[model samples]
Target: MENRLFYVMFCMILLLSLCSSENYFTKNVKGEGVLAKNSYVNHPPNPPIVEGPLVGLTRKAYQYNLTLIDPDNDLLIGYEIDFGDTIEGSSCCPIPSNTTLTLYHMWYNPGVYNVKARTKDGHGLWGNWSTPLTVTIMEGDTVPPVVHMLKPNKGLYLSNKRILPFPMNLVIGGITVEVEAVDEGSDVSRVEFYVQGSLKERDYTTPYSWDWYEKSLGRYVLTVKAYDFVGNQVSDEIIVWKFF
Candidate 1:
């Protein structure tokens, strides 16, 4: 009879232990915690191209491809980019109630700012202002300068000494020099020039005047390099003066 009574009490305690009576923030007896997903009471849309917080000149304009994620099949009603400060030509209007909106605006800012966006669903529920996209208006230089070598092959040249078996002691030649450069993405497509880096010649470009000069003193090497407006370079060399 006593054993039966003790068994009933143990069963009641075991039943109570199986039931947990705590909320999401509480840790269980085993030290493990159950957490909840972050609620998106207010999340903003992501724009293509320049990631949010873009900066531009006051007089200059830029375009943004704003994409709205539609959780429901409801119609998207309207959208706008709110420049915290006054922009030169900020415009806003009703959208086709579609999921995507493309926006173009010229901002004239005498100020620094935080810009946010807003849109409405067909169900009349206006979403929270998008995470603010800031635009800072400032001024600076934009022009890119030309590139050239101070000496040697402005980078272009190559030759075969083995072919010129008629080698000489007075042929004090065979030296190498380098050329380098950079450019803005626009302008003349490229730059190519020859180097007078050898005892073999004078002025390479003018072919008819094929004048090969004597190397009375020292060796020389010249190279010509090609460059694109975007600053990509390809360089090659010519051994103008190779003394064997």
Candidate 2:
């Protein structure tokens, strides 16, 4: 009985010593406990869903709908929009995630514009911009005018050559900008010219041509907005570069 008791005590002491050594190694060498303490996972919100009219009249208020989804179910803060006219707007305050939002805007002038939207999460992280929606504004116009840019070579070269479509070593100094607009419903009222999104000149007669001189050496987006007598409007744009 005595030998058996001594043997049991020795086994217990050995087991206790092994446990203590393992704990010391874990505390000193590893520095952190084996069990996980605090853990967190975060993900950015998904792109917003934007819905609005494709065509509308100028000076008229248009309503748009936006919806956002967060995979992690995080709270959304706010949203913003790019009106494509060099104007940007945003939500008034933070809102709940996975909800729909409605907003309104008006276009004073008639043109083809694009609108984009994005949302922010509660963590102040902004998600990717949503796919753009094209909005065409008209002057209470039902029928869009038919217009095209005339090239130097009438038959051989296509009209309205897009600049930056390909890199060219040659520089362009000045080019004659001309447009031919025809309306089936009514006579062409006027043709307006725009350079880099700003109005430059307008012609009220046929054989519409503008002597656009290169003010500086840079790239420019030339646009023409035309209207008919019955309020029908149309627009066309081209990219050009001026080296000299």
Candidate 3:
């Protein structure tokens, strides 16, 4: 009876060890298997790239396109757009990778706005928001500023006729270059002057002119560019002959 009891006790101990080993092997299999399974599940899509016009007219509908890519080739489920005007929109449906989603929006007031977008994959995971795109809305200011050079008129003979002989080059000591810009829709914001392809002066107010004290010799190209409040720009250039 003592030997039989010992044998039964040994068999029970062996069965318990086998059960423990099986439990540990099952846990190891789950840890490795679940990693592979979860890799393809619930992965977020990549951030989207938005493309559209940076400037648009108020009350006019503007269309924008968003491009999305998924790392796991998961189908893009939807897109969300925030116009930064307290308004948001969403699009639903499965779209393939590299497919562009189109959306349209209109603003009633003229102002600057930032637009942002996000994309979701088929697993219902939302990615991070994309970089914002800035948009400026104007109130129908389409006409460019009218600009012209005022000083150093073309064909002006600077040299004194009595002192210099005929057919001599026009010699000038110094001259003040001026520009006049007019904008009917918006006020003139600034004017830029370029001499020989180099920017020389920038004027922000009226009576736009630069007093060039240095005497210039030979042919010089003077360019004046004017901009309005709405960023409409116009440039005018003139060829002037200077001799010292």
Candidate 4:
């Protein structure tokens, strides 16, 4: 009876030691005294670097090198460039992280423009804009700014080429109208948002966007018109069905 009691006590002590060791390891691995899965946080990319000519001739294409680095080591998919002509340009192609890309642009007229750049990572997060580079154009031409609708259109449905009835985009709640405007010559002055042929709002800055809330649910035509510094204009429209 005495030997059996001793064996039982030894087993109990061993079990307690094992449990204590497990707890210690677990706490060390977690670094917090709790048992939980580690959460991942995505960091945005670093500000982009725009390198090009500080002074060039008008209407002549100048090469600019754009370099971006993601803090989380994510892949960079695109770039947003503000040419300081009041126009912005974007590239939606994926490129490796921490790499330099070359882009070409020309000024339509002679002016001192502050060019800046930013980047978007694969996770759809945008970084801050870089320091501006003042560029002086000698002589230039004139062209209308290019505009396009970006939001409210479901990505898969619109890009897939699947034909639908009246509206190309389907929205269940209030939607935001986002636009991308670019000009090679003159800078964009303003972007106008219209719904069902009526002007709703006008944005005079980069990342032109307007939030639209409609009580009634139905199909509506959304239009975005962009005007350049030279009074040149362009517009793009999209049809959307808003329902519950």
TM-score of each: 0.33, 0.43, 0.44, 0.43
Off by over 4 Å in 2: 1-34, 91-93, 141-244
TM-score ranking of the models: 3, 2, 4, 1
Model 1 scores worst on lDDT over the 10 consecutive residues at 202-211
> Candidate 4 vs. truth: CA RMSD?
20.7
Alpha-carbon error at 128 in model 1, in Å? 0.3
Put the candidates in lDDT order, highest first. Answer: 4, 3, 2, 1
Better of 2 and 3 by TM-score: 3
lDDT of 3 by residue, 1-244 (tens): 9999999999999868855552322234446522112222356778899999999886567899989888888898778888878656565678898888788887767899999888888888889998999999888766789998767654344442223343433437666777889999767889999989999899998899986656677887889999987667999997766766
Candidate 1 per-residue lDDT, tens place, 1-244, comes to: 9999999999998757644433124455788875433323433333312234377655445676666554544446555556675432222443433345555655544467777666655555666666767677665223343444433332222221222333321232332222344445433234354536333332212121222233333444444554443334555554444333
Q: Which stretches of candidate 1 lie over 4 Å from their true place?
A: 1-53, 86-98, 140-244
Q: In terms of lDDT, which candidate is strongest?
A: 4
Q: Rate the local accuracy (lDDT) of all candidates.
A: 0.46, 0.74, 0.77, 0.78
- Per-residue lDDT for 1-244 in model 2, tens only? 9999999999999868866553422233558644332335678888888899999887567898888788878888777888777555564566677799887887878999989888888888888998889999987545767988763222212223434434432235555678999987666889999988999889999898787664557766778888887666889887665555
Predicted structure with the largest TM-score when compared to the true one = 3
Query: Compared with the true structure, what per-residue lDDT tens digits does model 4 show for residues 1-244?
Result: 9999999999999868866663422355647665424446788889888899998877667899988888888888878889977556566677777898888887777889999888888888988989999998886545789887878665323322323433357665565677899888768889999989999999999899997765537878889999976567889988777664
Each candidate's number of clashing pairs is 23, 0, 0, 4
